[model samples]
Target: MTEQVVTGGGRRGASSAVERVVATVREGVKTGRYVPGQRLVEADLMRELGVGRNALREALSRLRSDGFVQIEAHRGASIRRLTREDVAQLYELREVLEGLAARLAAQRIGETDHRQRLVAALESMHEVARTAELPAYMDENIRFHRTIVELSAHPRLEELVDQLQIQTFRIQFRSAAANHDRTGMREYSVTEHQSLAEAILDGDGTRAEDLMRRHLRHTRSGIMQLPDGDFA
Candidate 1:
């Protein structure tokens, strides 16, 4: 993504038509832009986004596979709803997979451009958070977490982590912005990301692994405690 673009809706970078639709829908799910179990209107979106029907269908299919959309037998695509059980299971898997990814990424990252890329991503998220631009914060959040997973050396781990991270975004975005008190969560995330980067740069696999595990545990707890809706 280039420099951040501020849309009338909010701050999001420029992307392709289908990608733009996917992201708009995803954030809608995240920030209550769309409510749970809300049905998508292809005609409406096509008009709003200036895309054809095929592009909208493709985006919905992709999102359904990613666990963000659910298509009923007779009812078209609607945003997926997370039951209490669904949230618990997702958080459990996320805790384990993400911790492992971070540790593994730290095993291979050197002290150069790749590490710098992650730091930049984390800082960008921080800036968006400070500015109260939730969508940009969410975008950068995905990028920063993916940077760690991509460096982890195992392709399978990377894929699994990516899936869990999507679920994480769905939950957290549905919740609210991290509060001032939870600034600790933000600082801890940024600081650990920096430390993990250094660990990989140094090729200290053991430390990287341990830190990643701890980081995931912390994240799971922090996220769960944050105020979800009355139902959550």
Candidate 2:
């Protein structure tokens, strides 16, 4: 019994370590610290994350299943890069999913404190945009969308959107950062966000859904304009 207890505790500890490594790497990818196609050296990860070899490998495996990492037999692990078709298909799904989320959120905006949360999220985006910090703006942009999905009050919908958003994080960050020099583009995004927020707050479900879909379509168009070298 003593030996079994020790083994169980050890397993839990390793699992915790792996989770930490996974979260760190995911955040790095989302924030553009790790670019697509950049190799993830096992030794470096092990050192930086302060985990054992086994824990790091386990974390890499988890990230691979999450579509964030690609592991080649000989070349080892690198951040996954999406193809043009992949980007298109992802946006197509996002348009449907997020549009529905916005509609539902609008209908349910008065429930609980969702309205306040969403308003705060939108204000954060505006604050970040005013500073012209692309990274901060992108972070708040993600938070704003997440707020909408949370306001939808649908567990399964939130789960699906979260998965899709995770897969698209690096792509979104790269695309936005690449166009940071274009002030008009950033201003346009802020305007669209404000419009979407108003529709949701007003409980106009149809308008909210329409605006969300159009917003996603515009984002997709911008990503499509990126050079081919950015895609697989």
Candidate 3:
């Protein structure tokens, strides 16, 4: 009985450790501490995340599957970086998927609180953008998009978009960084997001879809303008 209990406890401990390491590493990526193409040293990550080597390794393996990290023999792990083609291809898919998501969400959003949630998220983003809080603005921007996806009421669509969003997060950060006039950029974002929220709220599916496509196109243009070396 004691041996069985010990084995179960060990499994639970490892599970918890894996969860912790995953969350820590994901947050680090989102917050830009682990920038695109940055090498991840196992020893430093183990110390930082307070996990054993085995658990940390397992967590890094999961991140690799999630497309946030790449692992290779001899080189270990590093954050995944995007090429110009990657940016183009990703945005192309996002425009289609996100536009469809918006249309579906406009049709189904009344079934839940997602509409109000989207409005609140946009308001929060506007407030933070005014203050020049890029991180907070990005957080709210993510929340706003997530709410729209949730309102689509399509599990498979949500899953796919979630994965894409994770991969494109660094691109979004770089796009924001490339802006020379942050105040103007923030104002533009607020205006665009407000219009998006309004279209969804009105249940104008066609308009919502078009607006979403336009918004994504604008972002794609900005990302493409970034120099090649910016990705690294």
Candidate 4:
């Protein structure tokens, strides 16, 4: 059953209903309230989200498109599970795409404001990491990376990165959960991000690209090292 209920009756209620239902399920998957391979029973979702069957199904469809849920004929819907091989494949593409974004961002980031935003993103990440808030930290981490992609001034590149960011975060979260030393991993993340920010700010495209690739490689290794059940 859903932990919270979102209801509808007003003029904007119908549209908002789907949005609320989607948000609930998306947040659940992100926070591990819904783990990988867990089936999302339609009736339970309808009651938990306080939405009708149609609205719940629509929400699940949206989640499925976002790579958060998988629906099969007869199997219904469940949180999408990632295999270690999936992790490797995703990271291989991420390293190339993100490395390119970082390089372009280094070349295009001439404005002081953009540089400051990168710094601010890193600062927010540090604050959340220090508090040991994994979800918040993950949000900030993605923000930091997305900011770089935005500053890259490559619209196509940003679109591509956006496509993979969510799934990548899903795997990363599970890996951190499986790791014995999450605190240490978080600390390591902060340091690496700070360094990447500095590299980009310094206008070193080559260094920025290399740093991004290396950082993603490390993340890939971390995820691959986790046991099978972590992502299951």
Q: Pick the candidate with the highest TM-score.
A: 2
Where does model 4 exceed 4 Å of error? 1-24, 44-62, 131-136, 154-156, 181-184
Model 3 over residues 24-116: C-alpha lDDT tens digits? 778778777788888999998788778899998898899888778889899999988877887788888888999999999889868858767
Candidate 1 segments exceeding 4 Å error: 1-24, 27-32, 49-59, 73-75, 119-140, 153-160, 173-182, 226-232
Tens-digit per-residue lDDT, 46-122, candidate 2: 88778999999999999998778999999999989999998899999999999999999999999989889988998
Question: What TM-score does candidate 4 get on C-alpha atoms?
Answer: 0.76
For candidate 4, the per-residue lDDT at 84 reads 74
Give the root-mean-square deviation of each candidate in angstroms. 8.9, 2.2, 2.6, 6.6
TM-score of each: 0.66, 0.89, 0.85, 0.76
Model 1: per-residue Cα lDDT over 1-232, one tens digit each: 2333336323222236668788888667655677767889888898998877777788888888888889988789887877656776776786677667766666556644666766676667667667755556657667777787776667998877766676567566544365555455456656776676667567676776677667666655555765545223
Could you tell me how far off, in angstroms, the CA of residue 51 lies in candidate 4 after the best superposition?
5.7
Ranking by lDDT: 2, 3, 4, 1
The model with the greatest lDDT is 2
Question: What stretches of model 2 exceed 4 Å from their correct place?
Answer: 1-4, 177-181
Model 4: weakest 10-residue lDDT segment is 1-10
Of candidate 3, the 10-residue stretch with the lowest lDDT total is 131-140
Worst 10 residues of 1 by lDDT: 6-15
